[model samples]
Target: MAPTAHSAVIAALRAVGVAPDAYGPTLNTAQSPRDVDVVGEGLAGEIRAVAAPAALVVWDTSDEAVLAHVVARNLDIGVLRAFEVEGLLRVSPDVPAGAPVALLATQWGERRLAGLRTLVANRGGQTVAVAAALTSPALAAVTDVPTAALASSDEVTGVPS
Candidate 1:
């Protein structure tokens, strides 16, 4: 199996003697609503930010409502249960309503650009990836890394490049 972009990033960080501890939860702006810090009627309220990824349907056996949202601001990904609005300011890194945000299942598809629509520019010196999904939006923008190569390739890259 090929090394994941996350693994590769970690390896590079280690090569430079950068401790993973540097980021830790500090780098984690996108947090789960169940984390206590976030408490509200819904994921948006829990996140305390608007447009923080919504209604992410997942495949689970129990069939209980499980949704995963991303903090488009800091590349933070999280899952939560569905609920009503908590009434807060729209401050998260999520794309605005009707901004053509695609709720994908983390699988690369023809609409890669739509996925990139969710990413917000880094704020407060946050470390964020070019694509919110990391390499899916990058698949089209794939380039050589040492001798690494993409299994399959396309140019329908998403996000603001």
Candidate 2:
């Protein structure tokens, strides 16, 4: 059977020498706003492990509540909401040039990859790290960007491998 996203994330954490159990409880207990969806298990841990300290985490607005909880927990972490461009969510142009950027996503698609590439190019070619619940071949094809696949399927869309 294909690995579930939750399992994938745990494996990735182990591969990095971080025990998933170390942060699982902390994330599970995070207090998120009532209106926004909470980030799934393993995702926040992956972000904490993969993203550099002080890196600006760019994410979909729908994830604001949980991501905010993450940022609150880690005072050094920063966040930015992806902005709409041509009806697709793209990295915001306001990200400071040369700032380390981490894309925290629940899924990957052509539009998301395009936005990442554009952000990289616009930011003086600094590679952007990605910590996502679901990934695709297109995401893997980008050899330069570092990524952590934190889940097997798109939880929001129920798209399984």
Among these predictions, the greatest lDDT belongs to 2
Where model 2 places Cα greater than 4 Å from the true spot, the runs are: 1-41, 51-53, 68-75, 85-93, 123-125, 154-161
**Candidate 2: tens digits of C-alpha lDDT, residues 18-91:** 11221111122223232112233345555556556345444444343354445435545556555656765455
> In terms of TM-score, how similar is model 2 to the real structure?
0.56
lDDT agreement of model 2 with the native: 0.48
Every candidate's lDDT: 0.25, 0.48
lDDT of 1 at 121: 18
Best by TM-score: 2
| C-alpha TM-scores of all predictions | 0.20, 0.56
Model 2, clash count? 2
- Model 1 scores a C-alpha lDDT of 0.25
List model 1 lDDT by residue over 36-148, tens digit each: 12211222222233233332321111111222333222224433221213522122343334332213222233333222222221111111111222124443443321111
Ten contiguous residues minimizing lDDT sum, candidate 2? 18-27
